[model samples]
Target: MYLSSVSRPASADPPTPGRPGRRFALVSGNVVALGTVSLITDVSAEMVAAVLPLYLVLGLQLSPVAFGVLDGVHAGATALLRVVGGFVADRFRRRKLVAGVGYALSAVAKLGLLLAGRSVPVIGAVIAVDRLGKGVRTAPRDALITLSTPPESLGRAFGVHRAMDSFGAFLGPLAALAVLLAVGQSYDAVFVTSFCIAALAVVILVLFVRERPEGGPPDTPDGPKVSVREALGLLRDRPARRLVLAAALLGLATIGDGFVYLLLQRREDLGLRWFPLLAVGTSLAYLVLAAPLGVLADRVGRLPVVIGGYLALGATYLLLSGPVHGWPVLALTLALYGGFYAATDGVLIALAGPVLPARVRTTGIALVQSGQAMAYLVSSVLFGLAWQLWGPENAVRAAAVAVAVVLLGTVPLLASPSRLVTRKVPR
Candidate 1:
């Protein structure tokens, strides 16, 4: 099978193969360290994310429009920063340091929530700060994973990392609930505890993660430092550009998970108490399937696996339209939803990794991610409007149609090496 363009430094050895005596010997040590950090950090971030909407909407009593604006900000405000963080990390060859800075910024923002209290503007600002840190850290962290692992095992490595990340997501809300129960429903205590956990994640990053060695071939003059212009020029490559476009297109069709669960709840007349459990179900599926699906992608191919994921998503939207109902539909939809994330989330980045030059891998990944985030913000707004005008069922049906169109287009765009490849230049 033809391989994608995986540009690793000549000096850096390929990732080690699985060993009989060593557990997880197939995966690199860096991936494990990063995954551990992500697991702890996600526990902290998800704790706040699970409750921030309630704190803003019910606690502060913001209007729907105002809350929607905050949500949009939470989703898309980091678009530019993602590019900046990626570019800076690539330029300085300090992926771990940049990632750590982002992690630190997020850890500190947990405390900012305490100071914000019930003030709407303050809360919005704090949320934006937290998202900004996520924006900054994500690309650099993903890039580190790509650079540190072998191309052949990229899917498995990312799968393992995302599974760990999803495991944290599954636990975060439970952790918050436990804190609330213990502390007599004190949000402040939750915030404080979250900050402490996040700080520990930062410590893990500092002590364990190592930056990959930089510099290309010995003969290459370390290719001029990656500048902003070069970073922007990343899309000039055909496959890279197509990948970005496809990601955005798919993202535009996808609505937020909250909306999906709300529809199911309304259809089933589910109790308010059980609403949060919907997310837990999906996270559980994701945690279970991420690693296995990733390994499947490595053994088979990433493109087909990614397409299968969106197909699962389309099925989810269709399921919401009520051809099927009750617990069976809910269970199937949640499983598909989880499968969608397992297939696409890390796999998309892994697909992008080999197609990009190592020098600007972070920037390229950030570009793809930012495009999708911006599209998702737009999609959320559009879906909300569609729901208001045409009702939830029709809106979801339309979304299913959109996903179908994009998924079909993406299949060919990323089908083979020749299509994605344009020209390889000395970096």
Candidate 2:
């Protein structure tokens, strides 16, 4: 089978409230139910990771570049896994099983962290392996999400999924803050708790979640076999080809979300770690706005959401690199930051899904995510280098500038998402 332009199959775990048949019947609809499971899991993870850099720097005595190096390895591993996992999902028809395995592995990694000694390399290796499973699981799980949600309601379905994911994101940091406050910012305790939460997420997947539009056996599904030539040919298709190109451009331009946290870290250096209370503020904002934004994009246009969102994000970063810091400033920045995530993430995923040939949906999603992973490697490395040379705040300013340039350059693409979006599928 060939690697065609990748498609996003619907995987970002969020609580999808039952969409009334106003659009299409919800498939597993339990996709939203599973969002809760993910939320619980993330709460466990965020607490540790939110302050993980501090652990590395304060506890491990690493440098900013080391932080970047770790980030690159994590993203790089996850990114490459997406390419391989997509093919497996498409080939074996075992999307759900793979997803289950991925979650189990991630949970195990978290558990391993609890047992490991003060060996930084060992812990880092475990995190990388755990992320390897994430790479394996994400495409198939997303494919399942897309497969489960009917075509017409794709935007809402993904929106719900992202919201759930974001909610988990919110809880993770908040939980971390609580742990730090209670136990004096102990990374080990954070790791132990996160392991338990991850365990719960895996349990829910095994017990409750089922793959939708269920395909073939784990060995192989009965679809047009994808040859490498066929995969390559997906790029030659008109809009599918164009959509993938646009995806690559965005991927190249958009910097790592980790940078945003780094920006928060800088604020901490500026005497504002207490300012991450603003992260909570941002999560709340995402909670309020994400679904509505999803519904809005469905009614208006995906381009408006994406292009406008990018512009807003650029402005948010610019403002962040401005005189912003402390409680008031951090709150404002994170509010827009979370909004930036809410506005763009689901819309981009929704836009990509409809444009590609259905047969290569798994790979199409993989391609976009892979492109993102590659970009993370580039941007994160650049950001890290800049941070080490110039310091965190200035490097962030550079990233914001780069984003503005990309946002402006990509404006032309948003003008005609209709051209890229495929004709409506049969009801």
The runs of at least 3 residues in candidate 1 whose Cα sits more than 4 Å from the true structure, single-residue gaps closed, are: 1-24, 56-67, 213-223, 421-427
- Which 10 consecutive residues of model 1 have the lowest summed lDDT? 213-222
Q: Count the backbone clashes (under 3 Å) in each candidate.
A: 0, 22
| Per-residue accuracy of model 1 over 1-427 as CA lDDT, tens digit each | 3222334433323344553233335577888899999999988987877666556655777654466567666777777898899999989888888899889989999999899878888887887888888889999999888876766668888999999999988887778777877877588998999999999999999999878622211112266788878788877877678778877887777887657776777888886445557777788899999999888777666777888899999999999996667898899999999999999999888777877777788888898989888888787777777777788899899999989988777767666456553222111
Q: What is the per-residue lDDT of model 2 for residues 79-123, given as tens digits with 9 covering 90 to 100?
A: 867877777766666677877777778778877776666677876
Instruction: Report how far residue 346 has shifted in candidate 2, in Å.
Output: 1.8
RMSD of each: 4.6, 5.7
lDDT of each: 0.78, 0.66
Judge candidate 2 against the unseen true structure and give its global Cα lDDT, from 0 to 1. 0.66
- Model 1 C-alpha RMSD to native: 4.6
